[model samples]
Target chain A: MGRWEPNARGRLEQAALELYVERGYEQTTVAEIAGRAGLTERTFFRHFADKREVLFAGAGTLRDDLVSAAAQAPPGAPPIDVVATALAAVAAPFQGRLESVRRRQSVIEANAELKERELIKLASLSAALAETLRERGVAEPAASLAAEAGIGVFKVAFGRWVGEPGGGEFARIVREAVDELKAVAAGS
Target chain B: MGRWEPNARGRLEQAALELYVERGYEQTTVAEIAGRAGLTERTFFRHFADKREVLFAGAGTLRDDLVSAAAQAPPGAPPIDVVATALAAVAAPFQGRLESVRRRQSVIEANAELKERELIKLASLSAALAETLRERGVAEPAASLAAEAGIGVFKVAFGRWVGEPGGGEFARIVREAVDELKAVAAGS
Candidate 1:
């Protein structure tokens, strides 16, 4: 094989997720994941630190997208509005990937370590969004509260989106969740 | 020592926290913690599953307090208000423990594993609150959103309280945070 492999990361992630679901996360091996992806274990190691990384590799990109969108929001927009808009914008990419997303969620939910990683990823995203809001001149507590609340909304919306039988759009659910959060916060 | 140790759990927790702060969590051993508490290793294990459990031992009691408070809220209160009130009620216990709380927070922040465990505790708290809200007649997304949003407020408020030099009251800070979250969610 050549030194470069096209889409090796994606291939490995897909292979790992499939194996995790089929054989259990604890039962799966890195060599098996690489072999299923039709790549070498060396190539796998080059792409991901381990099999778990395959599940969480997209977190960095997701955080970047959310932060960039938040940073680009209108200067005069409210902090919560900025966060909500950013959430919807980032969720757009998950529109057609419900099946895989559900599979991934199941895999994470089945394992304590993966659940912790997922929480950590969400916490990191919240912190990044809070920093972006702070840069936008939003003050303390408000920035952190808005960012954390936005993540709370996202988590609830994402859970609903994944569990819904009718398969709703992730972006729409996020927008509705933001609105629900507002109503809930207002004690209405 | 006999099989019964007076305040064994409390003594072990205090000893563990002191050791974790003084010698770092990883360097501290179960034997050292027990020795510091003037108890035996058997007594320590009788109280907690492991060293990490010392830090998290209060989570269950905290959850129960929050749930009980939520369940006892006035019948007509909004879900968000119920959560906020429960949060304040539960936070009152931390009034005189700011120093220990700060030390515990630092220890958890210093280690990735402890941080993950902390997140799991918070997540579990959120889930229990959501369940309580659902039983209170709050609907799907609203129950979850309110529960999670309340946890967000608590997190930000607790962080600020720990970092503040003047050492304000935890319940007051939580109240202020809830109001701030309401304002932020209102997009003001």
Candidate 2:
């Protein structure tokens, strides 16, 4: 549903990841990242609050898209169903960037701070999803249940897509995971 | 399933809460907390890893209990049902400390770091639940689904309990939440 900053963001991310791989998240300087991308540190700082934020900048956009997608879903749809669609709507962005996504995951998984940031991001997203459900008139526990369940689906499917053979097509795994959640809930 | 060092932990917790309320989490030093509790800083550190640990010492133990309880549920029980039972296992401890729990929640809700710790604890508990399901021979995705759904129930019920007029007992709300999840999953 969105991009971070069009071409500039993409360039910074690519340059940053390359340096992080060659060096490391801790070793890579923001200035060097900007220099490698043929951009100034001022440009990098303008886009990212910190070096770590380069990896997390998309989270805000994703949250916004999720809210919009949930709003645009068919009226009165079940919470999980609406959340599933919202997740699906964001899948296309990942499809073309599977390699980069995996690279980002690799970097985050290796750093405790990045991992904490990810957990915080996930928690906020779950809360946002719940808010969407509440706005749709779903009651307390059910809205929370659906939201957490949606986050669960997202978490597991993302993990699988990262590790599964030829699983870079995130949309398919996400759809399958949603179906699996339903089947499991149906006590399959 | 386990007592938190009998009355010492609870007493210390109450004392700590009082200090936090009167002062604040940041301003209240360990010495002040110990003085309020009639204990020493060494005693406090023995029970908790750090200042923040006092707010979270029960969660790890609680998560282990929940996972063990779920794993031991009847073979024929649905995974979600098993998770519900596991979650309900804490009803006794929670009920006994409803007021204290509410006080803790208020303290925690007022702090970002505490909330992050809570989210991380919940995430870890969710992962543990999934692992237990897998051990019970539940298939991939099913285990994850049951775990996530269980967490959903726990969060909803916990919120409902916290909102009760006189501060609700944890068990009753959890039981009701389990039923609510069952109802929603059944599309009732």
Candidate 3:
């Protein structure tokens, strides 16, 4: 039904996620995903390198946007503020996609391979963000520390946003997480 | 040369790390490592399930020690302090093994599969640490936030200890990293 769909990439992803949730990630195959999307295996391959790519396709853009946002922040802004702004900016597009994000996370959590890939992607993003902080003249340990803390806040906030019913905007949740992180660090 | 050696595990690990660094992680084989250690392949298997295990043999103990330290921290101690103490405890044993750690890190960094495994192990350690924090009455986001920050500190400190000559004791570096984390968080 979706083979001829205007947004073939989106349709293929939805089909893959639905299939993965129903049959489990390992049990789902590219052919089945394509069939469910009313597309062909060729089309599926064209859109995603593999089933795993469907879940991780956004990672590249997310990393790029986060680095750019941090790099473009005012030079005098505090490291945490710069990181928080970067997180907020990158998180803006995730708004209104809570259900999708939730489904994807569950699928990832259920599979070890997917979980490893997710962690690696997150690590890569953190490294890129840290590099941007360094570019802004942030010192060693501080740059890496800020970047890791930023990712940690993003993870905690994203988990809450996806799991809670009618969760508030993603950016707001991230802000709360950043505040909590500072408090946690300060031993408050 | 090492067949009759009393410390079979240590001999095998040293042989494996040498082979891995000299021949690359992928090029080194279990048989080669065993031969280098002057032990039969059977003995190597007796010690480690596989080549990768030789590199990760410490992960389980590291996780256990970290959790125990966190769990036993003085009641009412701050979460970050608890985490810092846990990290220091786990890092103590690594103080005199800087060269070994550096060799292993270089091998891990050179191979994508090994790198993924390393990240996954670190993530597991973080989860266990966070759970211990929860047991100590730290709440949701704070537990995870503190744990991630602690791991961040450990990673930064460990990298420095392994890469820099006379980097000082592992525990001291951990303490410095923890301080930097707090400063980074407070935007000092």
For each of the candidates, what fraction of the native contacts does it recover?
0.98, 0.46, 0.85
Candidate 1 C-alpha lDDT tens digits along B1-188: 35468788888889999999999999999999999999999998888999999898889999999999999999989998899899999999999999889889999999999999999999999999999999999998899999999999999999988999987999999999999999999998
Cα displacement (angstroms), candidate 2, residue B13, comes to: 2.0
Q: What is candidate 1's CAPRI-style docking category based on DockQ? A: high
Shift in Å, residue A100, candidate 1 = 1.1
CA RMSD (A), model 2: 3.6
How much is A71 displaced in model 3, in angstroms? 1.9
Report the Cα lDDT for residue A161, model 1.
94
Better of 1 and 3 by TM-score: 1
Score residue B15 of candidate 3 by CA lDDT. Answer: 97
For residues A1-188, could you state the per-residue lDDT of candidate 1 as single tens digits?
Answer: 35478888788888998999999999999999999999999999988898888898889999999999999999999998999999999999999999899999999999999999999999999999999999999999899999999999999999999999987889999999999998888887
Predictions in order: chain A TM-score:
0.96, 0.92, 0.95
Tell me the alpha-carbon RMSD of every candidate: 1.6, 3.6, 2.2
Expressed as tens digits, the lDDT of each residue in B52-131 for candidate 2 is 88888888789879877987899978887788789888666787677778878888888888877788888889899999
Best by lDDT: 1
Superior by lDDT: candidate 1 or candidate 3: 1
- In order of DockQ, best first, we have 1, 3, 2
Q: Cα lDDT of model 1 overall? A: 0.93
Q: Give the Å shift of residue B17 in candidate 1.
A: 1.4
**Runs with alpha carbons beyond 4 Å of true place in candidate 3:** A1-5, B1-5
